[model samples]
Target: MPDRVRPMRTVPRLGTYNGFGRTLLGRTKPDADGACFATHWFTLLLLPIRPLGRYYVKEGATVERSTGPGASTSTTEYVFLGEAELRASEVIRTYLFRWVVVPLVVAGPVTVFGLNSDAYSREHPLLFLLLLLGIPIGGIIVLAVALGLREKFLSSARVPEWVGSGPPRG
Candidate 1:
């Protein structure tokens, strides 16, 4: 009779599978707008130096390793700095990235296109107002989005808050 051999198995570190670094850059995850943070900043600061389209770079796995019950794998994701410093300027960059860029995307082009259209048209006057209003409105929207994104993604974890706003009685 011939002898049979069993395949080797491995166990991944606890919580490692749930980590952002691993899943974010893994093959199973699709390449999406994970570049939102980097894209946001470029659209603001650097885009003015060059052009809007040249801001964000491609997103993909930079490092990969397998470690599973049999063959699990992980990857390290990276964002192109695009002339922007990630550590030294994270706070300001994060602010600009989240707020200004995202909203301007919709408002800026619309206002520009609307205002440049035939001035003789009746809608031209309305578009002029729209062009003016769009600036501040876009700014506010960007601020809100930036604040929200920061709270959601940038905020660090801490101990849970106490219930009822104070100490609990035994």
Candidate 2:
């Protein structure tokens, strides 16, 4: 009988995104040269509708100078190598990542109000009640801010449809 050999298996890379709207999800782990495949998605709100092709991307850094006096910051940035097919699991990850963030989001206010309110509620009942109204106001402002930041980040993403493309990359 002829000898039989087993085929080698490759593991699909798994990645979670921190921001939404649309995304270029990493398709494979970065190789030794720091290049990988990433697929950009077309989305409606949080739901991913279609992949825009897989593009090659390289991991790199983006530096931004502050408008103020001599301040600058560097953030990890991806150089698009050019490719989009979004899997259901990747869409699900969008939801999962937000769920994971919920507790920490809720915790901040709860902790702040819980720790500070006892005396305030008892001594200044009306003011304490009024302070509760600020929660929704703060939430609206936060939502606006989050959307704005998503725009800034996506500007460099070459996101095809959902949002507009930023800059051309390799």
Candidate 3:
């Protein structure tokens, strides 16, 4: 009698490496809206995190030694959510903090910097310096805040639960 061997089968693996990858590659199941909202915003803010995690996580199966001869252990792994979720949450929180809180923190300094130039025109060259720096600093702060707000709104509007659900449960 001749020995026979079974053919091996392999499955293709896919993952995103950047923010866009998560938005594009993350599969939206009928009930996976929460995951999608998480994914979409994450993609906008931290595009690199999700896809990188996907790419780095093991997506294949391989054989290893088992207890007995002619026996092997093969393990197959799917994408990991630990790093992915953490990164996504951080991205969201960062945007939220940048947009919602940073302006208030910087506003007082900016206002005082601007006012210094009015009363001490002759006596304080440093006031002019502060005013000069303050304007640009305020502009940068505004830009950062704007970008954060835009990204947050865009991501937030894409809540998966609203758009992705299949149908009402009866």
Candidate 4:
């Protein structure tokens, strides 16, 4: 007897090339056609080190809600018709924006304000101490605020035009 309700297995298995495929980024919100851009990366220590490739595909998820110990519930997957295309710019921009740009944007002003706004005066050694303390604390506070706004920030991110001309995968 043939199997029924077969989940569409991805033909080109990602994350297996070079014995590593990790960090799928630049996944667009579902387009009008219900497909999105999915970019995978090669990672070291779970940090995306380089881009592997990208595909225009339909995203999939399997959610298992559980209240048990060590139980994980959500997983995301992508389905592409054919080979993934190398899209270096999109991947790099996404990576750099997350790791570099966001850091500078978030922390730069905090640091500036901490340094310029707070003076380390010799008359009050406490001021010096507070300056030192406040820099890190203020930075942490700003960082926390940025983290809190992460979902909103992510929601507003723009998705670039997919270079792949092929039909969107489902």
Off by over 4 Å in 3: 1-92, 105-107, 130-170
Which candidate should be chosen as best, given lDDT against the real structure? 4
In the range 1-170, model 2's lDDT, one tens digit per residue, is: 11111121232232233434455643444545665556566555434455554555676775666756875543456655433334455456544544444434544675688687998899988877666666645755775686567545642333232113532433
Candidate 4 per-residue lDDT, tens place, 49-136, comes to 7776565566677555775897644455666633344656667767786677655765665567556654445566777667656766
Worst 10 residues of 3 by lDDT: 1-10
Instruction: State the displacement of the C-alpha of residue 136, model 3, in Å, after optimal TM-score superposition.
Output: 8.4
On TM-score, the leading prediction is 4
Local distance difference test values of all predictions, in order: 0.38, 0.50, 0.40, 0.56
Candidate 1: segments with Cα more than 4 A from true spot: 1-86, 89-107, 120-124, 135-139, 157-170
What TM-score do all the candidates reach, one by one? 0.27, 0.37, 0.26, 0.48
Error of 3 at 37 (Å): 16
User: What TM-score does structure 2 among the candidates reach?
Assistant: 0.37
Q: Candidate 4, overall lDDT?
A: 0.56
In model 2, the clashing pairs are: 53-83, 53-84, 54-83, 54-84, 55-82, 55-83, 56-81, 81-170
lDDT over C-alpha atoms for residue 162 of model 4: 31
With a 3 Å backbone cut-off (N, CA, C), the pairs that clash in candidate 3 are 16-51, 17-51, 17-52, 18-47, 19-47, 19-48
Q: Which one wins by TM-score: 2 or 4?
A: 4
